[model samples]
Target: MLIILILPLLKANHPDFMNMATKAVKRAFLVALIPLLLFLSESTTGFIHKLPWFDIFLTSLDMSYKLDIFPTVFLPVALFVTWNILEYSLWYMAQDPNQQKFIKYLLIFLLTMIILVTSGNLITLFLGWEGVGIMSFLLISWYFSRNDAVVAAMQAVLYNRIGDIGFLMAFCWLISYSGSISLDFALATTAKSTTLPLVGFILAAASKSAQFGLHPWLASAMEGPTPVSALLHSSTMVVAGIYLLIRTQPLLGLNDTALTTCLCLGAISTAFAATAALTQNDIKKIVAYSTSSQLGLMMVAIGLNLPHLAMFHICTHAFFKAMLFMCSGIIIHSLNDEQDIRKMGGLQHHLPLTTTCVSIGSLALMGTPFLAGFYSKDAIIEAMNTSYVNFTALLLTLIAVSFTAVYSLRLMYFTSLKYPRHNVIINFDELSTPVFKTITRLCLGSIFAGWLILHFFLPSNDITHTMPPHIKMTALLITLLAFIIAFDLAKFHWTKEPKNKITSKQFSTNFYPIIIHRSVTTLTMNFSWNLTSHILDLLLLKALMPDLLKITQLPPMLMVRLSQSGLIKLYISALLITLFLAMIPTILL
Candidate 1:
């Protein structure tokens, strides 16, 4: 079935039937995914578990017993399979060749996700993870022919690899500390140990999620194509980190040290990224920064040991964020790829559908009442306030939530409400670019409340064990304040207009960006590292090189003395002690 769908993709560029190729791919996708659909059909009203299909993979590999098939494996795979069917539909309708390539990669990645989600063990999960990473690199560099795309892809891959180091470190630590790295044994050993794994797990999560020091790359990732942004901003991209954290959560400690670190990192990242978003000029970059901030908020929930709420926010935020990015893409496409929201205005008249969808998406982003974001995001704030005794974390999170409103509403106001700060030169070609339409519609769909599945499905009174009234009011009030601010911005935008066109004065536009571009800011920020490295490299290392050579010049005479001393048993006791210590772990295990 999968092969049938892939055939069209392989022949999408064929001369005679390019039109038929997309349909063929769609058919192949449906055929390939039927098994997954059938598997997910089983009802699991009580818990997130099911009979294990991974046993087949295990049996095929000639493995023994202990294959536990349950919901964790099935649910993610089900979601992937479901998303692929949707992607196939969207891709079949997307006419652009570049869009086809994007679709092709997306299909392959979804297949890989299926493998990862259903994997019976860590090995299987890692396999899918690397595939996801590789696909992300490829899709992110979708505009590889462009210089900035190449750079953005590079930054993303490099940053992820840094996180991978922590993953690898934890993997090795597991192997050394415990006999096996399997989840079951690791869980047992984690309880026995002083909880070293928890700290390592955190290092792994922080880097992967683009939290704190790992964050700048996520901001730079906006250089990629827009759909790529939507994917990166939502769904599998950033959420994988949180998923890993949640999965390994059993091993992680809830001690004061662990909680404090999580809270501090989450707060700093939440507040810092919000400030960063405040300065961004590009519409997508602002959203990208928001992604960072939102992810930080998710981390805060996770640190508070509120994985359920984090997961809840993850699902809802994914829908709304993807929606905003796709809408931004449409607006850019409508304006001939002019992404500066400042330059756009009065699009409401020209793009009625987009105006409505983008506004609601922004509303959802701001967590307006009755919207999916309202339920999920406010749930996180409520969880935070309820879980943490320290008021600092909750206070900071509320402040961060306010900023989300500010940036989100600001995004809508600048791009959708006015005639554009700069003149738009491109003609709208909605029929030619249906992929953008698909993504936009998907985003708008979230505003209506489909995303409340998590909140609705979980056992009633599980957390409150009651769904507090404050959740509704908090989200409503926060969203209203944000919307009011946005409305005021729109009113101001309505009253003001740029006098001259962008093309009319080239230097006029280039001058402001040149002065404000992050290059100057970066150099200042890295000044200490630069100064320290200069002295270390030029003065200390270079000067020490000759002195070290002079000391080693007398090695001929010293060699005989050293060899004679080694023969002497003066340090025999020390060597025995060192060997004994090293052998202790092997003996213990």
Candidate 2:
């Protein structure tokens, strides 16, 4: 684990660090994949390998590093996909002056994820957890000069901190009640009374996973670079929450309240984010929102007591989601960072390979039959259907499923289909060999990784488990409806221009986004004005100044008057007069 973590950081200090870091990461991932692949090929699974790094006895309990099947399985996958992201970034950040620093940060980012996944105890896991959050802040603010990037970075950090509070609370509770921060102890000692700690875990997971109320950060995170988005959305930041839940599934099972909370929150986040993705025009933001939506689905699976299925989706999602982000990066760069999909069309002529990638990734995301997403996504929906949940939760999950297809197709239409929107004569510029090769490999995964993983870990027929006809057909019907909705929505939004020129102008100008932007700006300005008027003006100037002036001036004025009068005699006369007036009041009383 130490060697693997250090490999990426070896060249982090090099002058030509950007290029060197990419090579280092790719090699490290490939090297890491070898042992994992070998282990997977073995006939026996669920083997526990212990590599004890630290050992301490807290009274009778053992606090030490240990390795198991779960971390072993996830480590190589994270390494492999993270390497792919780095390789993809070689081309994406090729010309960036700060590419070296960006590459260094990304390498550090991967290390943190590795630490989190391979952690032997909750304490170690939190270290990795905090590391990932810090790296996210740094990477998201890569373009620190851009106000949007700065805000996005701050938002990301703040949301994660909210989640961190939960983690911290859970840690404290576990240490106090269980007397150990080790996973084994926590899992072994589970009871219904463990709900408090479980609730903390849920809160942490919900925020980190970008569920519902805490989800705004995911959409706004697009202010970062495309590579940052790809790395973040795919394997590292968002997945951390899901991973924590999966890691603590045993403890989660102890508390019915925690499980139900996960279910409701997941359902709401899934539906809400999917709907938001449909209306968003920015390509990266759409993908970003979809990450949150899919995260919701993962949460739903966990809530439904299908943590393995959630992990399956995470593995498969990493491939296509990363490819899609990279494709978006390609398109955005080619068009001089044009992010709005409405302004893009007929990219098949200029970017044939990239367009194909977008189609494959988007279709996979839609859970189209036989794609990578199909195996896990369909399984998740089926699991949700069979779970004991209320109608509202079920409906929300189903609606989110359909919206996935709707927005996926909508994205493809505005991005790769329709007539050419660009006036310039376009040419087919072949992508650099490294970029093309890296993307093609990821595309292959997007096509077949789920199928292969499912076949090996969960056979194809295992997912179908003797369900009724209606139950089996649920995914199909929802997908079909999604296609229809996407087609109509696209036609309405992109194909047919408004009849009245003024209305057309309004639509073309994207009035809703403008309204939202203005609303936020207006609110912010009003807040500033109120602060200035109330806190600065009313409290400091109007209320404080005259009183301060009277107090300071009165003493000096009295001294000046006494000095000017040369009046020892006058002062005595004034004192006597005051005394006589006081005596007269007492006498009258």
Candidate 3:
């Protein structure tokens, strides 16, 4: 069944075949969703289908390969969200001549994510993990013409590789300790001290999900197409890290060190990202930072030992975040790719439907009452208040929550409400049929997905019932404050022109792009280039080898032509094939 779904994606390279391929992919996902829903409704327990691909037995241990159902609920979310993103991309990428190629990459991405979520063993999971990393590098750098996109793609891959190493270390520890690669075996193994594996898992989740120190890549990733942003940010790419933490809840529950680490990191990330979002003028960057912020909330939920709540929030956040990105995409296209919200205002007059959709998404993002985010976001906050966490975590989380509303409304004011600052004409009716259809569907999800998740999917409602009156009202009160702050900032634009020099400098220089470049990205890139490009490629591979010396001795002109003409593809293909071959023994032996 999955093979059938993947065929169209792999073959859909021509523009003539793209629409058909996209529809096939969407229908496949929709069809897959039904059985998933049935499984949930039937309250299915344990792995429904297990297929062992092979087995490995060393002198000391035996490990089996298999596929399982730990991410059963997550499968539906992945399918539904991927389906919508595919549908939306048909509209979003309609103008691009290379859209067929883009759709192929997107489908391959979904396939990898599906593999990640359903894999029963750590090894297969990591395979999918690395697969997504590769796909993301391709997708984020899709518009390779842009210098920023190229840099952003590299940053994303490097950051995720840092996380990948953590997963590798954990897998090694688990295989040594438990003598198995299965998740159940690892969880069931009673370790004298779980410090190594637990810490490794935390590091993996933090980097992959863009938690704090490893977070600079996510917001920078806005250089990609908006549909890519919608898919990556909303349900697929970012959620992988959260899903990893959720899956290992039992192990995380065992150690205070790991749990406390999650709490602090999540709290700090939420506050930091929300504050960063408040300062961003780029419409997509604001929403990108919002993703990091909301992801922090999910991390906090995991820290508080409520995996279900985190999953619930993941489902709800998926809808509105995707919608928000789509809305931002529309505005960007309508105004000829203008992303600065400062340049956009009074768009309600030009794009009434998009305006309304963006408003609903913003309200939901801010956790307004009865909206999707309201249901989970409010509950998460209430849980944070009542949990056995320290004041610092609680306070930081609450502050982050307030900032969510501030950014949400700030986006609204700048993009939809204020007087038109530019005399640019927009094609009010440019939305394609498929695009409008997907947007409408997403708006519905933004409005009601939260309530549905809370009622039908989550474990219980008793957590909210135990909270005090003030705790119940905390999200609402802070939201009101956020509205006030948004209105003030919108009207005054204090962020644009701070009275004090120090204040102006703080707002201008402290943003992530500047800070990350100065602190981490530039340093890392230089170090990597020194190690790989100069030390390995130039000296060890080329300079020392006699055949390579002969090649280098070729005329500089001929060498350049040879490299540019066709050798590059052969090299890439050879590298990929070699990597795949190297992994084969690990899987099959």
Task: State how far residue 265 of model 1 sits from its true place (Å).
Answer: 2.3
Candidate 3 per-residue lDDT over residues 1-589, each given as its tens digit: 3675676855565556666666666676676666557655775554424555555565222222332333555666666777778877877777888878887888888888877777667766787888888998999999899999999999998888889889889888887787776777778884735788888888999988999989999988999999899989987889899988887887887788888999899999999999998878899999999999999999999888888888888888988888888888888888887888878899999888888999999999889999998988888888888778979999999899888888888888888886787665776584567768778888998898887666556463356456678887988998898788778876777336555656545665256557766867688888987888777777787678965767767678686676565667778987899999999999997
Question: Best TM-score goes to which candidate?
Answer: 3
What would the per-residue lDDT of candidate 1 be over residues 1-589, giving only the tens digit for each residue?
Answer: 3354456566656653434444554454455344434434643332222233343422322111221222333243234323533442354325556565565666565556555444444555566667777887887777678888888788778778877777777766776666553655666665444446667667767766788777766766787766567766766667777777766655554455666777778877787777667656688888887888888888887777776667667767776777677767777767867877777877877776776777887777767777777776777777665664467766677777777777776776777664556555546754445554555546544765435355333522346556557653664676567667756765775356657556535523233334544676688779978999999988789768876676777787786666566654657866888899999999999
Task: State which candidate, 1 or 2, has the greater lDDT.
Answer: 2
Clashing pairs for model 2 are none
Worst 10 residues of 2 by lDDT: 504-513
Residue 125 CA displacement from its true place in model 3, Å: 0.8
Name the candidate, 1 or 3, with the larger lDDT value. Answer: 3
lDDT of 2 by residue, 1-589 (tens): 5574575566566677666666666677677665566656773344323444554664333223444555555665676777777777777777888777787888889888877877767767888899999999999899899999998899888878888999999888777777766776766776665787777888898888899877777877888888899999999989999999988887786667888888899999999889888778899988988899999999988888778888889988998999899889888888877898988999987889999999999999989899999999998888777656878998998999899999899889988888877644553254787668878988998999888777545421234467787888798789888899789888786577657756535323234345655787899999999888788877798668987889888999998776567758887888899899989978998
Cα lDDT of model 2 overall? 0.81
TM-score, prediction 2: 0.82
Per-candidate TM equals 0.72, 0.82, 0.84
- Relative to the true structure, candidate 3 reaches a TM of 0.84
